[model samples]
Target: MMKKTDGEKNKFSLWLLAWPIFIEQFLQFLLGSVDTLMVSKISDNAVAVVGFSNQLFNALMTLFATVASGAGIVIAQKIGSRKDEEARTVAIIAFKVTTWIGVFLSILLIAIPAPIATMLQMPEELLPLAKIYISIVGGGMILTAMMSVLGTAIRNTGNTKGPMMIAVGMNIVHIILNYCFIFGAFGFPQWGLTGVAISTVTSRLLATVVLFLMFLGTFERKMGMKDFSIFDRKLFKEILTIGWPLGVNSGSWVFSQLAIFSFLAILGSSELAARTYMSTLESFCFLLGFSLALAAQIQIAHLYGAGKIKEAYKAVYRVLAIGLPLVIVNAFILVLFGGNVLSLFTKDQEILTICASLLWMNLLLQPGKMINMALGNSLNAVGDTRYTMIVSLIFMWLIATGCSYLYGVHLGWGIIAIYACMIVDEYIRGVLSFVRWRGRKYLRMKETELERESTKFTESFASPSM
Candidate 1:
């Protein structure tokens, strides 16, 4: 095999790695859209019930996501070091962590789904629908959690395509099942909210099985308690050293968003509907940037792990350069075409208009958002997650969350005003990230040197430019 050179980015190869992620994310992105549509067909109240209740899942996932999300950096490093066994071990630990977390979440949510509904002050008209949606979705949280960790491991190992294909298949199955079960098509029972839940759980179960079977039958990899016991004390320190900062960074940012969501819940049911639809649209709109960000991380983590700091530096910007333009273009698509897109989610003219207005707001915010995503992911990939955590805390908590609270709740300026605060927050973080990159604060000497030496050869390769 030919040697790989430092700082060399095969745009094609990077995209090849990224396309599967893009497709995976695309299908995953459609999840909310599909669920929203399926339940909306049952009733507008069902839509709110389903939408509001999803926060519980998000809140639960937040606690355990680091187990999975932190695995990618470690896996990428192992691959760069050519230590597939270690990568496999990390994957096993991650699986165990999330599996238990999922099981607990399933029990907790199922036990108290009703109380959660009441706590959210969920629209009374939609409480029953909410209960059923929460019961089914929360009951099956284990399956979804399995899907998340394993999928992240799969993607991290440079085998994204298989999972993407499985995601597409499962998505199609879910949509079809939803149609049949929700409306009683094809002689299926017309179960409405319960039907949608059944379809979702069943599809997620299939996705988990397919992913596991792929490892067993195709990849021939098995993870268990034995594998988890092969602990890497050093790597554990490394993982947490880098991963915990990232966890804090990501948590701060996400919590801020959740806080804003909570604020909107108070505005009224219609506001909640508008926020949900806008959020769904934003999910799709943001996919391009996220996929590209994943590509950047994979590229940066591998190249940097292989002691190619110079190339890693160039790679981050190259990936960002490619993604930044796409973000701008996608925003325009949302601006020009958002009306038609939101219409697919709702028949309510007023709700449709609210979503459209929100889409335009998103378009204006995309450039800033793109900068933040590109820089943040790239920075974290290099294990400089402390910066991410600190900056995110400073900005998200004090600036973003505070601005959102004062305007949205205190001033009673409503959802649009709330978003205006968010736009400011996005740009502020975006600019700060850009500035951090220029100052090299995101890539300090200690982490870079440690990473470089980890894979650096005492003896050089024959071809420096391989």
Candidate 2:
């Protein structure tokens, strides 16, 4: 029998992880699109409300997702190093930490909905609906947080199918509930924006339950009460050491986005809704790139942990090589069919015109966006998170937000100019991240960290007090 070459094995691993994740994220991204399409039929104000509510909800969710991000990298490395018990323990810790954070944030959002709505500059007419939507989904964030950690951890172990199944089932439930509640179908009362929120929360809650059962069924791989009973100081510190920076990185992006939304509000809610529709369509392109990037991250993490640093580096380029062109072609098609796509949401000629023009800009934006997505995930997976965070803060805040306000608001260059400024941000960061990848700083750091973890894992098993 012939043995598989290392290259062939790597190819199998990448595809094994990538395709399921792509399908999962596609469905997840579709949730927002479905909400926007259905809400667009209700009223322009309702559409704008959904847009703002989504932004705020996503920002908070990103913050809650930090623990999962850290845990994912650690778990991936542990699995690669063949330390299954340690990986399972880290997964359980991640579940607890994120769930507590989610509960806290839920209460905070429920209590301060008005402040959040005001911060997003939600229109006065839409503010009431926005508050209701945020409160319901925000209050149910514990479910979202748990599901996120479970999905990330399992994917790190090369079980992408578990999360993908959950995402598919949950989205189906959300769509059905949305149809019934949003329009009073099947004797259900019309709930409008509030209905969307309820559907989102309820569906996510179901995902959490399904994920828990799925995670538990792997008897040899399962984590138990004992794993949660004893506190591991090093584990907690590792989680925090990696998690806090990710939280800050995600927070900076969300805040800068809110600032951009505030700037867009000046152009009127119609334009805000237009931007929302355009962004939803653009997410389709990104879903392809982002999923491939994640596949690269998972493979790279394992290779780095197994001390195959050179192979890890090569894996990154291979994924980017495929992902970049795919996204470019996808963006081109989106530009070609821009008007027809926009018409799916609303018949507003002005919004459609503006969205079509933005699709042209997407031609320039998607390449740079793909670069950033690929390298940024690679950097984070190898534990060079702080560098990416610094880069992101600088470009997203100092460059993207500054240019957005100056061109879009002060100069009155409108949405196109703001998008142009954003492109500049994307290219700048993309080039910088590419350069960082070339330098091997993260590679060296990962080598040291993996060695230390190997020692720690061995000691923990031998002495139980190490």
Candidate 3:
């Protein structure tokens, strides 16, 4: 068992946990942005292909996120309740489950990259590059899965710094490798998109290895082969119960985004490239809220596990209070300066004009997204995932996808109108999530369960020892 101390407790505070996650997330965004930036040098078509392929990759990652999210919440709660053994068991199960899923996904993507790319309505000219990038990176899903599970396990233990350090190292390696392969530096052939994909996979492989070693050192008991062999049905059920909704929720967002991407593909390469560039810049604004929401999720899970229901409830509000303003400020900065940032990638006036309009729309979009993330994550932490999942499924498809088709495609309102649809979706879902949290239903349910458990304990003690 890792020794608990004042320092350890202090590390669980929102700010301490969030800052490292924020940096880690920033580096992650940088990793993708760098890929897009470097590849944009090849051509805007290359950037479009890269962005399209990544959206598919992200959709597949929801499978891994299912396991990671489930396991992370369970581990945090178990640790909060001081059930270290259970927490460790959950971690092992998560690793085992994610490995199988990752392998299957890797094979699927690698074997059928062409078909998948075609189904996503990838442009004919882009198919060859898309296939290569997808196969190379997609073949490495196992490494990505391992990294996701390992990072989630480590962070939920309130040791966000370890993952942050790993990300910093991985990103450094990634940039160097990207330069060598993409630009034909260090005597390497200029592989272009293929080189970027290879660099991504290689960097992930290194980070996964380092993360596994760090995972071994973090826990009290050493993990052996037998640990992997062991299966706990109840714990597995708990993980799936919490994880599937999260997976579906994430799936809803990614799939809807993919649908929207296909719509942009119809709009032409200029619109697609513009959307790609804005996504990179807009990530900076939203990641602030995402990092804070993730930290609050961890903290809230711990509090809920320890039966501190009120504290858990208040923690969500605290995160909202802190996160919303920062996200708003960040969005404003992006709106003001996003064009300069876009200029770093492209000089095309049409793309720049499209991206500028999107940034203004993003200012309206981001605050709602921030609110949704803060509240939705809190609900997930307490195992109240179904509501958020349902809300996401309904609104994301209806408002996000349906309206994009209606306003952007069918009515030919264009990309700006598509963004307006998205903004409406975010606020509607955010408001529903807020109402769900405010109702205190999850807290009441948890309290009832605790009382029942208390009754059982009393009954056991009152009876003769058997």
lDDT of 2 by residue, 60-135 (tens): 8787677898888888877676677777778887888888988898898889888888876777777888889888
List model 3 lDDT by residue over 172-252, tens digit each. Answer: 888888899889998999998888889989999999999998887666687876778878999999999999999999999
Top-TM-score structure, candidate number:
3
Worst 10 residues of 2 by lDDT: 1-10
Sorted on lDDT, best first, the list reads 3, 2, 1
lDDT per prediction? 0.76, 0.82, 0.90
Model with the higher TM-score, candidate 2 or 3: 3
TM-scores vs. true structure, each candidate = 0.89, 0.92, 0.96
Per candidate, the number of residue pairs that clash is: 2, 0, 0
Assess candidate 3 and give its TM-score to the true structure. 0.96
Worst 10 residues of 1 by lDDT: 3-12
| lDDT of predicted model 2 | 0.82
Instruction: Rate residue 110 of model 1 by lDDT.
Output: 88
Model 1 misplaced stretches (Cα beyond 4 Å): 1-12, 30-34, 216-229, 441-466
